[model samples]
Target: MSTTALSSSSTGSTGQPPPRRKAPRRPKPAPGTQRISPLRVIGLTVVWLFTAFNLLVLYWLIMAAFKTPLEIFREPLSLPATLFERGTPFRNFVYAWESAEFGTAFLNTVILVAVCSVVIVLVSAPAAYALSRLGVRGSGPMTAFIAIGMGVPFQTVIIPLFIAMSEIDLNNNLFGLALIYVALSLPFTVFLLTGFFRSLPDELEEAASIDGASATRTFWSIMLPLARGGLITALILNAIGLWNETLLAIVFLQENANFTLARALFTFYNAASYQSEYGGLLAGVAIIVLPMLVMYILLARRIITGLTLGAGK
Candidate 1:
C-alpha cells in the first residue's frame, strides 16, 4: 500500500509540469561590420546640407520667375500667391525673346554646337587612334604637344586668336565661333579618346586583319563600333562646353544681333536703365538651363555607363 501511494504521488508530480526551454542565443555582429565612423557621418551631413542649399536655390529661382518685380521685391523667398499668378512672366519672356532675337541666337547656338562636335569627333578620334594603335613615329611627341596645349589658358591666346580671326575675316561669324570651339575641345578630346582606344583589345584588330580586312576597314568596321560609347561621351561633353561658352562668344560676337543667349542676358541690366528686371532675368536663366537639365535626365544612364567603361580600363 505504501509503495503504491509513493509511486502514485511521484507520477502525479511528474504529470503536473514540465520545465520551460530557453531560446537559442543569437551571435553578435562582427567587430567593424556594423559601425558608423564619425568621419563618414560628418561627410554625409555636409553633402546633405549642400544638396539642400542647392535645392532651395532652385526653388527660389523657379518661384521668382513667375513673380512680378513688385512681388519679387516684396516676397523674395516666399511661395507664389497662386499657381496662375503670371505677373507678366510670359510677357517678359516674349519681350526678352524679341528684344534679343533669341530665335536666331538659338538656331546659331544649335548649328555651332553641332558643327563643332562633329569636327572634334572627326579630327580627334583618328588622331587619338593613331597615337594609341598605329605605332607611328613622333606619336609621343605629338601627344605631348597636345597635352601641353591643355595647360595653356584661353586668356593667354585670346589676343592672337582675335588678330588671326580679324585677318581672315572670321570674326563676328558663327562659323568662326564653331572653328574656335573645335580647336579648344581638341586637346582634351584627343587625350580622353586615346586613353579609351588604348584600353581596347588588340586581339580584335588582329582577328579582323586575319579576316582580310585592311587597316582602314578594320578601324571603320570593328574599332569605330567598339568606340561608339566613348564617341557619344565626347559628343555630349563637347556640346555642353560649346553651349555654355561665354567669354569667346562675348569677345568675338560684338554685334547685338549676333550675341548668344549668354551675352543677351547682360542686356537685362543696362547701367543707364537703373532698374534691373530680376524676374525676367531669372526666367530667362531657367529657360536656358532647362534643355541641359532635360538632356542630362534623358542620357544620364548612358553617360554613366560610357564613362565607367571608358575609365575602367
Candidate 2:
C-alpha cells in the first residue's frame, strides 16, 4: 500500500497492469504459387524445342543407317526393318570398313593422333610450367608472343607450309602432317596450361625447394601429378580436333592409303552418292563420329572439371 500500490492504481482502473498489445501477423503466400517472367518462359520453350529437334535428328540418322538407300528417303522417320529381319545388322559397317578404305584410314588416324597428341603435351607442359612458375626473364613477353600465334590463321601459312614440306620431301607424308599438328597445337596448349599452372598453389614448390629438391625433379615428382588433369584435357582436345580435321588432311594427304578418318569419309560420301549406297555412307559417317562421341560422353565430366579447375583464380 506504499508507492507500488499508488503507481498501479494510477496506471489502471484496478490494481492489475494494463493489458499488453498483440503483434500483427503476416499472411503466407499460397503453395505452388510463383512469379515468372514471360521472357524466361519463352526462352525455356525455345531451348526445349531445339533439344528435341537434335534428338530427333540423331534418331533419324541411326534409323537411316540400317535402312536401304531407297527406304531412307521414302521412310525418313520410320524405323529400319533391319532391326527385326536382320542376317547381320552391321553389314553396312562392314562394307564401309572393307570397301571404303575406312579400316586403313582408321589405323592411320589412330597412330597419327596418338603420336601427335603425346608429342604436343610433352613439349608444351614443361614450357607452360617454366613460364608460369620459374623466375625466367621475359616470361610475360614470351607468353604474349606465344598466345599471339594462336590468332594467326592457318590458311595464311598453307602455301608456305606446303612448299617447305615439299622441299623436305615430307608432303603427303603422315610424319610431316604430325609435325605441323604439333607445331600449330603448341601455342594453344602452352597458353592453356600456363594459366592452369599459375592457378596452383606456390606452397608446394616452396616445400619441395626446402627439402633440397631440384626444379626438374620437383616438377616431375610433385607438380606433374597435380597437373595431370590439365595435361589430359590438353591431350584429349588435340586428339579430338585432329580426329575430325579435314582441311589439313585434304591439303597434305594425296594417297588414299595415307588418308585419315575424315578424309576417307569425304571420299566415301562422293563414291557412295554415285553408287546410291546411302546406308554405307551413313555407316562411314558413324564410324568417323562414334569414336569421338563415345570418348566425349565418357570423359565429359572430367573435361568439364579440368576446364573449370583454375577458373576461380
Candidate 3:
C-alpha cells in the first residue's frame, strides 16, 4: 500500500467526513389538465343556490320569531325591532310556551324521545352485533328484510298501529307511543349498527373469547365501548326522527295532555293563525326547529367521523 493512501485513510478515520450537499428538489408535476363538465358546473350552481335559499328562509323565520307582528310584516328583511327593546325579545317565546301549553309538550316530547331512543339502541346494538359478527343463520336475508322495512311508509302502518294500540287499551298513552316509535326505529337502527359492527376488528372479539369471555360478556365489555360512536349516532338519529314525528302522535293521541312537540306545534299553528299571532307562530316553529339545528351544528363533526369510521376498513 502507498504511504500517502495509508495516511489519507488514517486521517479520514480520525475525523468526520465533509457534510453532504442536498440534491435540488424536483419541481412538482403540474396538476393534470382536466376538462370541467358544464353539466356538473350547472348542477353545483343549482345546489348552492337552493342551499342559500333555504338558509335565507331559516334566517327569516328566526328573525320573525323575535319580532312583533307589525315589524315582521313591515320590515321582514330587517332585524327584529323587539330585539332592541328590553323585556320584549322573548315575549313571543313566552306567549307560545304559555298559551299553547308548549312547556308540557316539550317535557312530554323529551321523555318520549329519551325513552324510545334508549330502548331502540339497547335492542339494536345486541341484535346488530349478533347479525354482523356472530354469523347467525340467515343474517343476510334478515338484515335485508329489516332494511326494507325502512322504506315502508309510515302512512301505511298508521291504521294497523292505531288499532293495535286501541285493542291493548294503550291509546293516548305515551308508553304505547314510545313502543311504536321503538318498533318503527329498530330497522334503521339495526341496519346502521350492523355496518358499524361489521367494520370493527374481529381480533378484539377473538382475544376476548380466548380470555374466557362469553359472547354476552365480550359484547358488553369489549365491543360495545369501541362502537360507542355508532351507538351515539343511532341514538341521535332516532331522537330526531321521534322528535319530528307528528303523524303517529296525531293518530294515537287525541287529548291535548298527551301531545308531543310536533303534535302541539300543529295544534298551535291553527290557533295562532286564527289569533294572528305571527310572532308566536314563528316562535313555535323556531322552538321545534332550533334544538335539532343546534344539535347538528355541535355534533356534525362527530357524526361524520362516526359514520365514516370503518368505511375504509
Candidate 4:
C-alpha cells in the first residue's frame, strides 16, 4: 500500500462533524389546535360554579339547623348567635322530632333498615356463593333471571304487594315493610356478590375442602368471611334504600304511627306550617340525611372497591 493511503486510514474520521443525532420525534398534534377550546373552558367553569353553589346550599342548611325560625329568615346567612344557649341550642331538631312524630318514624326506619340490610346480606351471600362457585346446574340462567328484577321498577309491583299484604293482614306493619325491602334488595345484592365471589380465588375453597371441611363449612366459615367487603356494600345499599323509601311506606302505612321517616318527611313537608319553622324543617331534613352521610364517610373505600370490583371482570 502507498504510505499516504496507510497514514490516512490510520488517522481515520477527517474533519467531518459527527452526524447530527436525531432528536426524539415529538408526537405531532392530531390535526388542529395549539390552544384549548373556549367552549370546553366555559363548560368546566359552569361545572365548578354549580359544585360551589351546591356546597354553599349544604352549608346554609347545616347552619340553619342551629338557628331559630325568625333567625332563619331575618339573618339567614348569619352564624349562630351563641354556642352556649340554655336548654338546647338545637331545639329546632327536638321540636321537629317531636311535633312531626319523627321520633317514631326514626325508630321504625332504624328497624326497617337494620333488619332488611342484615337479611339481604345473609340471603344474598349464600345465593351468590352457590351461583358463582358451586357450579350447580342452571345457576347461570337462575342468575340471569334474578338480575332481571333489577331492571323491574318497584312501582310495577307496589299495588300487588299492597293487595297481598292487605289480604294477609300484614298492611302498615314494619315487618311487612322490611319484607318488601328485602325482596326489592335481593337482585342487586345477588348480582354484586356473585361478581365479587367470582373474583375470589378458587384455590381458597379447594384448600378448605382438602382439609376435610364440608362445602357448607367452607362457605360459612371461609367464603363468607372473605366476602365481607361485598356483604357490607350490599348492607349499606339496602339500608339507604329502606331508610329513604317513601312510596311504599306511605302506601302501605295509612296510619301516621306506622309511617317511616320518608313518609313522615312528606307529611312534614305538606303540613306547610313549616314555612314559619324553616329552621326546624331543615333540622329534620338533616336528621334524615345524617346516617347516610356518616355511612358514606366511614365505608367510602369499601363501597368504591365493591362497586368497581365487578366492572372489569
lDDT of 2 by residue, 1-313 (tens): 7997789787887667788798888777564343675666778899999999988887887787788877889999998886448676777888888878877898999999999999999999999999999989999999999999999999899999999999999989999999999999999999989978998899999999999999999989999889999999999999999898898888999999899989888878888899998998888888887789889989989888888885655
Question: By summed lDDT, which 10 consecutive residues of candidate 2 come out lowest?
Answer: 29-38
| lDDT sort, best first | 3, 2, 4, 1
Which residue pairs show collisions in model 3? Answer: none
In candidate 1, stretches whose alpha carbon ends up further than 4 angstroms from where it belongs are: 1-35, 86-89, 271-273
Model 1 per-residue lDDT tens digits across residues 15-129 = 6534569899989866545568666678779999999998888888788777667777889899766324645437556655665567777777787788889899989998899
| Best of the candidates, TM-score | 3
Question: Which 10-residue window of candidate 1 scores lowest in summed lDDT?
Answer: 266-275
Query: What's model 1's lDDT at 288?
Result: 71
Model 2 alpha-carbon miss at residue 266, Å: 1.7
Per-residue C-alpha lDDT of model 3 across residues 229-260, encoded as one tens digit per residue:
99998888888888888888988887889999
- Per-candidate TM-scores read 0.82, 0.84, 0.85, 0.80
Candidate 4, which segments miss by more than 4 Å at Cα? 1-50, 69-76, 80-88, 272-275
Between the candidate structures 1 and 4, which one is better when assessed by lDDT? 4
lDDT of 2 at 56: 88
lDDT of 4 at 97: 89
Task: Assess each prediction's global lDDT (C-alpha) against the native.
Answer: 0.80, 0.89, 0.89, 0.84
Off by over 4 Å in 3: 1-35, 82-87, 310-313
Return whichever of 2 and 4 wins on lDDT: 2
Count: clashes, candidate 3: 0
